[model samples]
Target chain A: MAINRLFRWITFSYLLFFSLASVASDELEELVEDLEYEIEDLIEQIDERNKRFKINGFLSAGASYSDSTVPLESTDLLDEVNFSPEAVLGLQLEFKLNDKSKVVTQLVGRGKTDFDIVAEWGYFAYKVTPALTFRAGRLRIPLFLLSDYLEVGYAYPWVRPSAEVYDLAELFSSQDGMDILYNFSVGSVDTQLQLGGGTLARTSPSYGGLTFKATDMITMAALANYKSWTLNANVATVDFVADITGTLLGDADNTFTSNGAGEIKFDHLDILYYSVGAAFDNGVWMFQAEAIDTAYENRPGPQIFPIQRAHYISIARRFNRVTPYFLFAQNRTVSASDRREADAILAQAGVSPFDLARVFTQLLDHTQSSWALGINYSLSPKAKLKFEWKLIGSTKGTVGDFEDFAAFTSILGGQDALDGTNVYNLVFDVVF
Target chain B: MINKINSLAITALLIASPTLVLADLVVVVHPDNSVSSITDADISRIFLKKTDSFPDKNKATPIDQKEGNPLRDAFYSKVTKKDAAQLNSYWSRLIFTGKGTPPKVVRNDKKVKSLISKNADHIGYIDSASVDDTVKVVFTLK
Candidate 1:
């Protein structure tokens, strides 16, 4: 219901602005000239405050195909080709109050979300000194190297970042937060440290949509750049309360006892996530690697509390306008003790044999590895085209992160538990 | 008449080839600026918004030429070791992430010079052929 209201508000705002712009179209040219003059006059009148404003936007459209007939988790990844999974558009506005202060806002619409506009970030910043800055309001959680600009497709070379590493933790990307950033130089190396604290309340589109409210979220990050090499390290922790609306576990009786109608609740869920990464780019060759670890604890249900560790390494070489890249990523989940405890409890609850099997399968640790080969071509200064072929394989388990245990086992049709999937994607991304 | 036209074409090609092969870009600042010389790394850091002030602690405001200008392309390639497209990609990350913004853009070298001359801390780049007394050349890329 809240999502609906937000969507309607954004739509109304856009419509009202367009209507007003159209009504004033005849006088727009003259009005623009007069506005410029007025701006100059105002600048002179308010000499102490220098103000500037800018607007920018990005768009991405793509089609993807997977060689599996069964859908992957709740995502729209099916056997045939599809366009709705990856297309997105975003707009950003910045109002510079002066050299030391500014406000920024960004809105994004995605095909997967039925083109509903969502506010991605809105924040105010003030520079305390050349070496220190402060920001407050809604901002991205700086968990990964690409977290700051993950939705801006034109900012990265690949059509998408490595999902194995980035999606290891089901955490909100943005929160109502305050952060302090400090930048300094040690000899010839540039270094930066960011410390933040925040709270989050959002409905994430994972697991058919899960609404979570988290508090006391704290984060710390450090980065260093020397010559052509850059390194980054980050850590974050949060305590959350979630109401699971989707059937994550195929059998609800074995998983959780609902407090009310469709209210599968978990309180005081604590999570910790950390990552370290390094990148090297020298105009011709580029290489990047990152390792992420996630742990979930303090849950009051038979759900799997996976302790996930994931990593990826990518290398690319540029030949003028074309770049060819290769990536390898893997994720491993450890939940043996958690699953054993859940199995004993469910057995004591007198669960049926078939339901017991399903619950145990869902609790097993899932592991998967993926490899991708792609090429990026620069069409222009603002546009790029990318094509990638990826292969994902699992050993001793179903593909982790791609599908829940019940969905994966159902797709297997009693075949071998190991599975392999092939996917291909072509995308064009631009920013203006 | 055909030979006369062929000679004219050859003359035009000869005139254009040198401009393409020998385009020199020079970074400029106001004449009153305290700093006289700058390293390529310093120039990159300034333009990329890594620092807001010069080594002398004076606030710096970098300016840029409009996209697709040859001088702009040459400047980035020589100073930052990045092409125009790469720079655009870099700026997209910074701008959308609210980390920093690209420099203010002007139409031509004359405007760059004019802006630089009006502010002692302002910095810009232009074709070496346009160098004049109004602006001081801090760094040159050939």
Candidate 2:
């Protein structure tokens, strides 16, 4: 598989780099001794210089058990207690060439990716001025406030960010791109502005094993901080494309496949996403909330592109080393008209009764909400242990993001419809 | 004899209270640096790496005391409005994102003074009792 090959390549590259660094350090040690330099001072100098090029990382392992099955392609939520859903190890290396220029790279191995190493970020940054910076190469898409460090579990209070809000935009977290950032102050208010453009592609089983590609992806963000409060607004637009092959659609459409297996191709599908968020953290009490709206246009075939909206609010109060938090999140799809049009198209195509029902369910507008209560206990400055219990409820339609309603019903042998489920998670996160 | 012992204990408690409540922490820069005084917010910004330059437009290189030092904890809580653990978490975000790095760390007040004496742009903090001509006190957090 391509993922297996990529994993092997990354492992080999890390070994090669380590071997070369060891040899170089040995040679430098001999030279320092030969010159009769003060060994202690020379060693300190070497350490000081090495500190400029820093390496840091984080590891998170979590186990989750849900009361009912939320089944999807390739994975199910209620397969007993499982750890693969939220287990990852990330390593970051930053090389500062000078005061104004640096290179940074982060590699992450995730259980969901079959433990394959993937490059999360690799970028070059240059400081144009004290307040202005430019970065190029692969970078995180600033779609949400926590987009930059979404995978770094130790950076946030939750075992995971709310699935209702996070999973909807999870497909496009990174882009091969360039961005400009500027930080300035206006009357005691610290403000930052970022503009970026890039290309991105990812394949996900949530979307029926289809590969989504976007071109000319543009993003902009503005952030302002005053005292203990921070506010952020973000907007992004992209031209998306995807090819739906017969293998992906499977036997769901047997009549259409009989006529020489045609592929469903969508080109120049435009998508726009906008979000605004605010956070208040004053060392004791913390509050965060965000609302996002996503719109899609220009879809071909019987596919219905819906306008999706999501919001989440979380509050936590610190008590010494322990913090308990509460979160409420909701997601909805607004596409009743589009769903009716898709149903009409399927009916005119002479689709079978079972296949037509499946397609119709996939296009239906759905709503889901979740309420979570959690506690975070700091084991140390760099480590934390968290426990969370969440209750999720959904309407009868297709529960689109992490759990699909159709799949849940199918897993239940079509005897019972899934309306709600409880999930429990325990996680250990550390940064080094 | 019991009264005499109680009187001695009271004197000890009175002496220790001032050290806990009045540990004078002073921010310092090189003696040659033109920045004579800085606001508490500016000191916090410089130490947190929110702003890279000082008020006088010179490049600023902030230094920090080694971890576990009382002076370090006091400085962060008073100026940055964060505890040591909170500061660590804050820096972790910046470090992992490649946005900024934490300041260089020295062992004690003597090393802080030594480092500041060599670099005009260097900034550090020390106990007020350790203030010397080698470093200029820019802001005092007491």
Candidate 3:
């Protein structure tokens, strides 16, 4: 009887253990299901966040070397290779306020400037209709085809845009303005027309970070896209002034003063810009050309009203993952060298006019031409590696945008060495 | 009987050559969409975000397959004449300039059909073999 009782007890305990194990298994499954739901909810939350805010960025790291000590396109390459001149990173943030309105901000950091972050774009845009858009605040001054995305290296084929055309009007990069964009199609061609105006208060980094301020700035642009071809035209005008007290013409002569004032004020100056560009790409081959002219309408001083015309043509062909490109560019000051103002200023300052006249001629009679052969290797769809060899030249006895011309010529013992100088550039570009 | 024979023939062709069927893509819209056909130019214009409406003046929304998909490559090459790199470059120019944005991307042909079938304004491309009654074929790749 005792053996039978022990057997029954063992059977009951076994059944009880099995039931408890099944209960625990059910609870475990429930816990896993709940975790899965929580994970899915988190993913949905992240997706919703992404829909409201978007981020994009681009980076370019470039190294350059030049045979001469002259800076090209603000690149401080002089015999020794320099990496910081072209190294830049840009971040763009787009916050979607609604289906029809958004805010965008872009920040760029440059290695040359010690990686100082600068706000290149901060604007609010509203889509009034499918074909029209309105934007206000700090907007890029779209004077050229690439001017809007100049620092976004992955947008174009070159390590840097041809400096000849892009460098001429560097004073106007952005303006606190309002613009309206109208898009329409004519036959098979897509066209966009932009009209904008505002005041500009910014420093001209290209001109040694001089304080540049403008009023009554007006700009108009047109872009037409037909299949693989894109054509752009732009015109802008501004009444501006710059602090040219320490640099440029004023610095040429220490005794030089404007109206006996300690500093020269480039005030009440009227400037005009005209630009035209065309680009064509057919999967295998690409071609681009742009021409620009900058004219000072008000000639307060003969040396002050300088007119410049520049152009560049680039042709490239793609071979699988590699592309080879060739470019030719030229820049010329169309204005004649008139040293009348310099003579007057020198006479007033009781300084010898001969040296000042020569200085004015050297500075005003600028001419430069360059050619480049470059190859770009696609690291991926969003990245590229480029190597370029470029050579620049000028007319006899001219410096052609090179700073400290007198010292450079004296170091070379003659002006013939300034005729042609070779520059090498290597760049890696990526967009995300 | 003719439709039955055509289906049989297509099944035979698919069984005989899968790569050919893979390249055979059909642009689709919701079944209720009134638009029946699209021209090559209009297709490119819409996909490129150059135009936001169809020929019938109905709002058009474009959807894209994930990057690196061979089907996406073939569709873009045949319709828009743009490769992956070129498209990226084009959109990069637009995005930073605040000009426009590219189309929303889905995972695959299945997701494309699912999305297109749920919205009358949505348009996407899928393999011809995956075409079903849920989505209407607006254009067939030639």
Model 3: lDDT of residue B116: 79
List residue ranges in candidate 2 displaced over 4 A. Answer: A1-44, A72-75, A247-265, A298-303, A344-353, A356-358, A361-364, A400-402, A405-417, B1-22, B32-36, B55-58
Which sections of candidate 1 miss by over 4 Å? A1-51, A205-208, A244-265, A297-303, A344-350, A356-364, A416-418, B1-19
Docking class of 2: acceptable
Candidate 2, A1-432: lDDT as tens digits: 434544555576557556654566566445434432233334446667777788899999989887765542223567489888789899999988898999999999987778899999899999998889999999988878788888788888898877677766777788999999999876557788999999998886754687779899999999887777889999998998776555434344343334322213456878889999999988889999999999876654444445788999999998978999999998888766655655555567776545634453354465777789999998988898999998776645455444554554453365433456777889999999
Per-residue C-alpha lDDT of model 3 across residues B1-142, encoded as one tens digit per residue = 3454586697677457645547578999999999999887788888998877787878899998878777788888888887888788889998887677889877666678767777899999988888989899989996
Regarding TM-score, does 1 or 2 come out ahead?
A: 2
Candidates 1 and 2 compared by DockQ, better number = 1
Give the top-scoring candidate (TM-score). 3
Q: How far in Å is the alpha carbon of A125 misplaced in model 2?
A: 1.6
Model 3, position A138, has a per-residue lDDT of 93
The order by descending DockQ is 1, 3, 2
TM-score of candidate 1 versus the correct structure, residues matched by position:
0.82
Q: Which one is best on DockQ?
A: 1
Tell me the lDDT of candidate 1. Answer: 0.77
Which whole-number lDDT from 0 to 100 does residue B18 have in model 3? 43
Quote model 2's iRMS. Answer: 11.8
Largest lDDT belongs to which candidate?
3
Off by over 4 Å in 3: A1-48, A205-209, A246-248, A251-265, A300-303, A340-358, A404-413, B1-21
